[model samples]
Target: MSMRVLKSTGAAFVMQNMRTCVNKPIYKETFDVNSLKKICDMLVVSAQQRKLVRLAICPQVTQHQIWTGALMEILNQLEIEMCVKDCMKGSNMAQQIVVNCLRFLDDVVSYDPDSTSWMRVAPKKDADSSPSAKWSDLLEMFNDLINCLKNDHEFLFYVIKLEIMKEGLSQIKDVLVDKNIGYKEALHQQSLVHKKLTKSLGHSSRCLFTLLLYYLYGSIQDIELDICWYSEDVSGNKLYLCVGKIIASDEDKMLMHIFKQLDRALGVIKFVHEMAEMKEILEIQGHLWCIGSKNRSFAYRGHNFFIHGISLE
Candidate 1:
């Protein structure tokens, strides 16, 4: 462990006897965002205090590394620090709130957390560590997917935008609401931001979604999908929020197909959502459905979409 660690990372507060929720049934929670923000805030404050201390009793030039590490720790605090300015759920916030959320997402994504050291969740031991399974292969695949998440946001988003364009305006409204970016202006802002970012960066860029999917499961399967805002009542009441259909089958072929494309489609969905919520031109998140017939009945298939405790699309 590095001796030059920042005090009050806010980890203690986050772990202060909080209810231990693993994978949520509906949504996934990765790093504690609120805790992250508070840590960043303190790191910033500590820097100011340090500056005053430095002025009075400046350390030796050899001690520069210590101060540098301190600053670096603050810079690295972004792993958890997200802009808590926006509501995590609900469609009530105005365009400003949407923009605020987008900005937070943008900064969070754009800021390279790997640039400096950050807290990492411990890895789980594979059950197949015995002589039978290729344990090294599993580690390689896992590492590859992590890289994909780190680098593959833009390529994934492009397909999502295409899908959203096909989904129509009312559908677009549903998308906004799902991501907590609702109302006329916020949706428009996301579109506008995406346009600006994509314009300078070129329209066709590649991301790591497919590659990562291939790395992890050898393909994307066990995906959950839905169709939203396609139905309207006679008087035009918003009845169906989103229709979910998990593509599953007893036959390996059908299940495999869904699994293979799932990562790619989810990559697309995440791309769309990230781009939409980014303050600048970052991608938000988006998901797709492949349930054509829904004939297969597997006990495990229904809950496939929400694996990591985070929402899929």
Candidate 2:
């Protein structure tokens, strides 16, 4: 097919055809570096346009020496430096291309050749041998790409921020919250923060709150919830507060002040409601300490709890 035809056909169709072609020995023999480069160029453009393209090059493809050599050559010619420069200039398209390329290389290098189905054909003894030359080359190429990307300070900052946002999002579901309501609420908040971070480098108040939660109380299993009614404020408003304390670690001591600020910024009622939802969901027992005023009315997991002046010391 002509290059124009391939481009118009889109990544999904081309990727499927490439996968099928790889299975044929003649296709492998005839595939040259220029052809592979063209295919990759198409993929980069598609990905830049935010289209998903299942990677054609993977561990299974690398099993063939010819394909591996072609991949190495294409990787060598990758315009990673130019792409990163564009990324530093605030080009989201360039950023997407760079991230996709890095992730693609990461997938290739992290794959275990032994896990491939073709490995079953080889004897166990042969499969257990040291890493093959192709694997070594892929690893070297991945490292080179990383080194190149890291050379640009601004690009490296952007990459680190993206990774932090990813980690924060992944852990949001694991947060100890009510399955019915708190889960959705927490997810929405986290998603908003992620969206803001993606468009700009600035951190919003919600971003600070998110980073604090994930950084300090990320593991719900080891967290302790302390809820209490402090003295009435000057305006005669009763203060009900909930504080998250790390039960098993001393790391909280150093950042205790910062955590307090972040928690307080969310206000007492909202904070207590959030913590109560989590406490009920996780069925956390014995770690909860309630103090101060009796006859304080508060809401916990959609239930009204009227507690007399009782302290759980």
Q: Which ten residues in a row have the lowest lDDT in candidate 2?
A: 281-290
Candidate 1 ranges beyond 4 A from true positions = 1-200, 206-250, 278-313
Cα misplacement distance, residue 232 of candidate 1 (Å): 7.7
lDDT of 1 at 169: 20
Clashes of each: 24, 2
Query: Tens-digit lDDT track for model 2 on 112-158?
Result: 54433332333233556663222233333344444555546655633
Question: Candidates' TM-scores?
Answer: 0.19, 0.19
Show model 2 residue runs off by greater than 4 Å. Answer: 1-84, 87-146, 162-273, 276-313
lDDT of 1 by residue, 220-276 (tens): 222333321122234542211111222322256755554444434434333332322
